[model samples]
Target: MRHLFTIALVSLLLAPPAQAQNDVRFQVLGGDEALRDALIAASRLQAVTDEEDSASQDIVAAARSDYARLLAVLYEQGYFGPDISITLNGREVAGMSPFDRITQVRSAAITVEPGRAFRLGRAVIAPLAPGTDLPEGFRSGAPAGTVILRETTEAGIMGWRTQGHATADVGNQQITARHNEAELDAEITLAPGPVYRFGTLIPRGEERMRTRRVLRIAGLPTGEVYDPDEVDRAADRLRDTGVFTSVGFTEIPNPDGTLDVQAELVEAPLRRVGFGAEIQSQDGLTVSGYWLHRNLFGGAERLRFDAEISDIGAQNSGIDGFVSGLFSRPADLTPDTTLELGFRIEHLDEPTFVEDTASINIGLEHQFSDELTATAGVFARYSDVSDNFSERSVWMVGLPLGLTWDSRDNAFDAASGWYADATLTPFTAFEDGGGVRATADLRAYYGFGEEDSTRLAGRLQLGTVDGGDIAALPPDWLFYSGGSGTVRGQDHQSLGAMQNGVQTGGRSFAGASFEIRQDLFGNFGAVAFYDVGYVSEGAYGEGASDWHSGAGLGLRYDTPIGPIRLDIATPVSGDGTGEDVHLYLGIGQNF
Candidate 1:
């Protein structure tokens, strides 16, 4: 007969009865402090005995069930033999019958005597798959904890399953305890049913999305060896399209040594609309809204239109507005590729220039992995400009190439990981010669302390426009500093390069920012930040340049979508130089 005890899952807390009270006192003998605490926590009597309305029958039931629960806890800690006793009002709970229940209960006592800890005499598992790694403590002469035995067996089973064995499981397990020698012997065997291949992918529960598009988006590998990782990746690809409210996969075994995958999906609503607003002391107010259609033609194509107005009630600049539209189709050329068509018309009124522009772009974005993507687009644009320079109408053609890598924990409020984006655009003008513009944004975050209560984040931004004079290019394509997005404490576009005694957006720019955030209490947090910016008339900070710095403190309130942010800052160096304070309100982190 097996000497080891069998463990079963049991609910630790029982519902309290009304109109009765009972006190529970627990003790553990012949055990260390850690063992005593574990036994008390595992006992059901200790979980609910303090309830003010616990009935006598409820208390008795809890005390009776605690024997198995406490024994299981002891076995996990290498204690093979344990003596457990429970009494109600000095009467043994084990001897009482359910039919003979007392009307009221006063007090209950639980005592546990954990015997000597055991060590493994022999631990073995046969025929493990290649590259299977078991727990470090699963070797002979180590502490004979039941958790180690369970983990060792699970690792063995999962190893075979990764090698195209879909039905791998435990064949047999033997666990024996020798009380006299304080030793345990554990042996396990795994059953790898068969090597299977992928048969077909079937979609279910989809109402609006076409079945062919679903297959294209998922791109499940048929006629290939069944891989659990591939199955999971297919599910992730479906979810990333944002057309499904819920997505899941099920495996069906076939008689012909193949596995059929069933994709269950719940399609989301076709249309969505949302709006957002942000305000800064100098930059003024920006309000934007978007409308999106998830399944425009029943093939998971997304059509979206966006509009924005900025510089409302500002002291420095006139109002600016734009309307833009984008059409995107997934799996256009490859399973990971998306085709994009975009159109935009905009009017800009700034301190140094006023312009109207219209543009159209066609592009392809390819997702190389979950964290990396590359894009290439060709655009045609027309712009009419009026500035200190002569007014002119310019027509241009450009090619934009970009790459992005993001692994942040949260895009809105990241606690860890890195994000980087780089874009380079080359253009040819109808009247003037061609030039190239390049920009990059990089950010990193690290979290420490309990539950990531503290985070340190940093960002770097760089921009340069080369192969043309500063006055020859579109003013909006140039760079400006001293705003909420750069140096928060200074006026919007206040710092720029000087050419011909006139201040204008820079040909080169560089900025760096850092913040330390700490959780204060509840959903509230505090942050301290420092920012520095530089601009020059020549590319790559070559010609005359100026530097400015700002420092501030902010507060944050967490929400489901993101965090509500409020910041107050002032200039610390260069122009303004600690003279004025600026306030900003927005959603999500400053980055």
Candidate 2:
């Protein structure tokens, strides 16, 4: 449509001038406010309005182009009949002969008198399949817009395609404009080919991956009715497996009412290595690295190894180290399920205690659907932990079960949707006793206004360990709130159970946070948030009810990976010395 207007403008712009002139201006005269504004917006004259030394021919060309664009826009807006005139300086475009020459030009004018808008006089679409989704404006007596008419045609074809018809399209279309009655008559015919079922899938670009596995991963249900959504999903599954850098699927025409599927794949690099580092006010320097093998054991299985070391600042000496190895087998028992195996080792020396642990777990994660997943596993751990008051070594075995429901549109900047997760782990201390640990977390997000620029996000977490001795358990198993992950105004794990003037992880924990986010200009945005947390040595009860709160403001810069956050908060109320403010830096939202 725009190209058509440009062509018209080129023909209208015929300037016989000797010298070039600048200082172009634009004006919209005589039309309805909305229509006149639309024409002005459609005009291209304003693009070169600041060209002070433009040639006379340039100004004339600009005006002519503006007139052409304005006319198209007027018609598309349902105004088939409109009076349009383009004037350069004081000379009318029609009055200037082909031989007339100009030396200088200053002003340009576009006058549009858009008449009454045309309505849909007689709208008819033949062979429109039942349940076809269409625009409301495509009906008779509604405003006749060119865009709407095109959308109506597309909707009709899509309707047939949804009902197993793979080759459905608009066979013919006729749109007649009537200037006498200010109306438009539209007629469309559609052709839907025979219903198609799924056929055999042929694979290509399979260098490292086996063709049979590729077909299995695609998981296309053969003999089922054809659906474009299904084809797209199969391709998406191939892409999400991490084994493929690129994936494509094409439909081949076949006989017997079936569409043959052709799969094209690009295998990702077999091995990858990367590293990262971060610095914080309280935690010093943290460095980390990882290695990955996408097709470790074939069948799109992944193997990974990672290591991290932290607390390396000049002033701080409480350093920590961690290492882990992970493996996952895709499509283990079901297409959307995976078998995962993991082993981890960590050494921690904090203000509260010194702790070391080695843990291993084997789990099966089944994706029930796009929004939900369930994981069940058995884990074993051996840990030696000591604090100022006590020290202990323990061996523990546990059964872990977890479920998560996530509907957030974007992980970094979620404007709408809710997420919830729950985990229950029952453990037996080999030489001491037995206990049960349970936790549930809920997060919700909602946006207001256009494009969801303003959003409200919130989270609530609850946890408890019922029978284990708090001093004997692994430090990581216990909960402590106060950090970028929880209340930001306080130091890391600074608001936990107090023992002999030192902070210690608690068996019972609760934390909640709320944020109001508003995007500013470009990639910048601002947020106001409040967070509260409670931790105690005993399970959640009256005696364990010491809650600390923090309220503050934050700034965020959006990135493809996530949002970079800088939250500066002050303790609203809690175990703090006077008014201590803290600044926390990280990626992604606080949650």
Instruction: Give candidate 2 regions above 4 Å deviation.
Output: 1-77, 82-114, 124-133, 136-138, 271-273, 313-317, 449-451, 498-503, 536-543
TM-score of candidate 2 relative to the true fold: 0.82
Per-residue lDDT for 237-260 in model 2, tens only?
788789998888888758788888
CA RMSD for every model? Answer: 6.3, 6.0
For candidate 1, which ten residues in a row score worst on lDDT? Answer: 4-13
- C-alpha lDDT values of all predictions: 0.88, 0.80
lDDT of 1: 0.88
lDDT of 1 at 386: 87
